[model samples]
Target: MLKKLCLALALLVMPLPFVATAHAQGQSLNDILEPVRKEVGLPALAAAVIKDGRIIASGAVGTRVLGRDIPVTIDDRFHIGSDTKAMTATLAGMLVDEGKLRWDSTIGEVLGADLPGIDPTFAKITLEQLLSHTSGIPTDTKAIYEQYVDGKAYEETLSQSRLRMLRAFGKNPLKVDPNPTFHYANLGYVAAGAMIEKVAGETWEELIRRRLFDPLELKTAGLGPQATRGKFDAPVGHDVDDKGKITPRPWGPGADVPAGLGPAGVAHMSILDFARWAGWNAGEGKRGPALVKPETLKRIHRQHVTMTLENPPPGTPKSGGYGLGWGIAASPWSDNRPVLGHNGSNTMNLATIMVDPQRDIGIVVTTNFPGPKADEALQSLVRTLYQRFAK
Candidate 1:
């Protein structure tokens, strides 16, 4: 179907208008997410809402297999795709707080002369520029981009393995250089992850487990396919064919994204845990174990660059900007200004998390199936949640 067209369909593709301002029916979160799952034909779907650092409402609906009778649970994991960017950026901030790295530290400075074939210009790229996707790194080009989706083992250390992909981009001139407009660059995040590897002197996976996941207690969080290694205990991602018949594909090499691209996305967890992280961010560092200082989290959420969507991608906002890891926009139904949320997918799944920092509330939704239909379903569900719960 539409999912097989390209890796990601960038627009929301509004299927119909939503009753965003409708009063809550005292309906459970399951009541809200289940119908959307059925109507959209997603293999499985999950959602949760967090207020004041706690999950107040959460649920899941549908089956692991699209046409089968296997049921899913609230604990079933779903890949959150690029939504992982925010978490990676946060981990980087922790290192910065410890003075292990600086926001302005250059890749050249971090890797030193040890990395081979890196151009002088690329070496000059900084943490802020890289994280913000304005460091002159091009959005992963098609050939280079596939390197991430395949889950290839990049050889040695995390930084060295990931940096091999950057040699292709090292000397490439930027579309716009020196603090240009926002461009979604997956490679840029990988580059940043490399810097993290050097500073932490550990694999990105180890650092995430020790520094973030362990502290936050994101029990369901992991890298790659949500499906367990040998079984369909979790929902398996599907690949839709030309005639629209979805093939249920279990977790395998093709299902995993390259670890080098982990900083850009490739994270999977239950909807509840995803919302927990969002809620922590919603508190703006005031709650949830104080992962970073309040101002640091605020800086992460602040609008750093604006995006113009005159003739935008399919899923892009009509008019909006981007913060460090979030797309900054306003909601008509909620009093939430700069409604902070992001849509994530790996061409086989779709997920979203919306946080209203003003009310210290966050909402997250996910679908095991991907494409335009998934986007339409998630955008509608998010609208319902914010309209019903936004302060």
Candidate 2:
């Protein structure tokens, strides 16, 4: 009887064919992300991949605070920077859907007496042109930041002052004819946000919360650090100085939030919350409650204008194209896979969010540090993740 029991135990201990199968199927998402993790010096990263309106995989790596060793969770929030533009564009599309505005309506028609020194030519600029950044208006955020926003409250006086500056300089002809060619300008989105306020009769933040965030149940997503303060964990922002040491910057609210520039940059969110946003875009207006109609999202994703490498504009790589508020890049891992997404950078942080709509796959990465090579590292990590999942 003992010999017979021993023989049965040996048989049970022997590996079954399904063991290898299960091992292969259960390979961790971290397996693919680890390489990029080491290369990028990302102290913390939270990411999720969606497929068919479901979160197939989600995880976090490294630390939320560098020296604290507080591990990052999927809900850790980060400054998404220009990805805010996508949210702003969605809001604009919703306004269009609600009949509050038209794509062809001129900026002057909406802004009316608020903007001074009105150029008649610019008065004819359409909402579509502003959304696509063909309004011929230069991005004045840098100058505005240096001159007015450093430590002061952005009041109506400063807003009017900037408008005067824009009117004075906006007389130059457009770099490319509107609607058929792309030229990214942050001022265009700033103008779009202003239009939202003017037409909706509410502050931009209140309108966004009522029309966009509340409807989608994105309780934690907002235009500035104060919105999420004490409600979620946030990462510190950093930049490498000339001496190559990582220096920390004061983490505070972004001035662009209240200045009607929410459409260009200045959004705050967590990876999990942003994943829900990606799911909505990837699913084509099917995920969560519908903020904008399917037709509106389709218009947002359509390649309304072509971007050329020879004359790449601000806030974009020479190799990428602009579509509405998002960036379009050719996917390296698939045959003719055109990925739609955006990359964002501020003084102390860098971020990228990409989605392959056909495959229903998306990646969201945020880092606290900024350097010359950070964007390149982000692009490379995106490529690596695509290769891993594509196979």
Candidate 3:
């Protein structure tokens, strides 16, 4: 709600009749996105507007990499960093639907036999807390890097590495005493992913592809780096230097946030496919391939914890309710009704999605860039689309 007024400002500047005419005539989303992309100096930007379970408007604009002539298309894949958490959570929900797990399923109950040395406190942590970021797991960048990059975690299998991470971090004392305090941590998702994969007898990567991607028909979706190693087949994520220069990271281990963290983030797909996922979530089980029961899906969207940010960091909500992989907040554009939203970034690329189940509307925006400018550009575009579409 902090920047809700920006949408109001956008309303004042962008005339209603013009937007109505453009929508009626099936105007290219490029017309609306190009100016914003230029204004923000993003390498590339893609977005789609989903209304009533259909992509009513969609577009991709700008170059594949900044300072290059190679252009991007609507089909180009873009990395959606932590937004992958929702998919992982959804996978857990699927397991729950199949009677493989439960929301109250504890780490000890699921993994204690495997990890005999797990901390007693950590052993009691529930799947719900892990998904909601209320499991007392603090953000530990050092632990992640030590395990994934600097250490030998990458050499082992993904599931093995995650187990190692759980063993290592579980020994530490809880970050918060009460157990339900909100402390966003990628590690929590990693642990949750481990539990899901263990119960399902597959890796998180395979589970996501089979359980979520294939079922949702998100053909463009994939794990790890979006672009191919040698070819610019997709829009590569760009890194902004201290001098404001942008560099595209297309290949190598550095392209993604470590394969082991797949359960937490490191997913990429075309904007339309991403919009399809958003649209399905917006449908709130009304329309679906029935990935999970409608009540179960609704439970995932329900707020589990309240996140109160005193001085919100870049790309974070000022204050909102966080559900399983979703930021449940009131969208001013939607008359302040609670909407499911989330922003994902790995400091190179950014992706944001907002789903209004009540309205059956979803807006997804992604760019081959990150930081304040990209965030503002996407937010503005979302507001613009909400103004034109959400009828």
| Model 3 TM-score relative to the real fold | 0.92
Q: Please report the candidate that would top TM-score against the real structure.
A: 3
Candidate 3, residues 267-304, lDDT tens digits: the string is 99999899999999999857778999988998899999
The segments of candidate 3 whose C-alpha lies over 4 angstroms from its true place after superposition are 1-27
- Per-residue lDDT tens digits for candidate 1, residues 125-224, read 8898888777877555676665554344535555566876776567564454555666678788888888898889898878888888889888999988
* Highest-lDDT candidate: 3
lDDT of 3 at 176: 53
Best of the two (1, 2) by lDDT:
1
List TM-score per model, in order.
0.89, 0.80, 0.92
